[model samples]
Target: MVSGGINEILRAVEFILSKLLSELQSEDENDVEPKTKVRLIVPNGSCGGIICKGCATIRSFIEKSQAGIKISPQDNNYYGLNDRLVTLTGTLDDNKCFNT
Candidate 1:
């Protein structure tokens, strides 16, 4: 049961990230300012129980949280589709994530 719950959380995180990236990529280039915020929230309760669970379960969640899109600042890559979306979506350091 614990493993399944963790999997769901991992998937949720990925879905949120993907949406953020997509939103960042659809902005107008001529605009002077981007107006969007990207936030990810992982509840403390999700990570609270079952310390004795298998290593695979723990590792999977950790890996998913660390997963992120990599953007290149050169070649105007920062203005690329995904990059723009990310910019409009704010950042991971915004109010999306919290450590409990």
Candidate 2:
């Protein structure tokens, strides 16, 4: 269960980073890193909660709340086809994720 949660978080982060990279590509043609605000949200009523290493907070939330991890393909119309554009739609504890 813990491993599964870790994997889910990793996958979500990866997807987010990919989108960020694509967006940054259209900026000025310089080797400068753009500053951006990034947030990770997991359903379990942990919004605004402090984040730490080892993911003890999220792991504990999942274990105690019995929340299930859900992932789906979200279309952003970038590919002009819903099926071709894939993004992560994750929910935990009956709430829409990425709220934070």
Best by TM-score: 2
Give the clashing pairs for model 1. 24-84, 24-85, 25-85, 38-89, 40-96
Mark the regions of model 2 whose C-alpha exceeds 4 Å error after superposition. 1-4, 41-100
Residue 45 C-alpha lDDT in model 1: 40
| Per-prediction TM-score to the true structure, in the order listed | 0.29, 0.32
Best by lDDT: 2
Residue-pair clashes per prediction, in order, are 5, 0
Worst 10 contiguous positions by lDDT, candidate 1: 80-89
Q: State the lDDT at 31 in candidate 1.
A: 44
Relative to the true structure, how large is the alpha-carbon lDDT of every model?
A: 0.40, 0.42
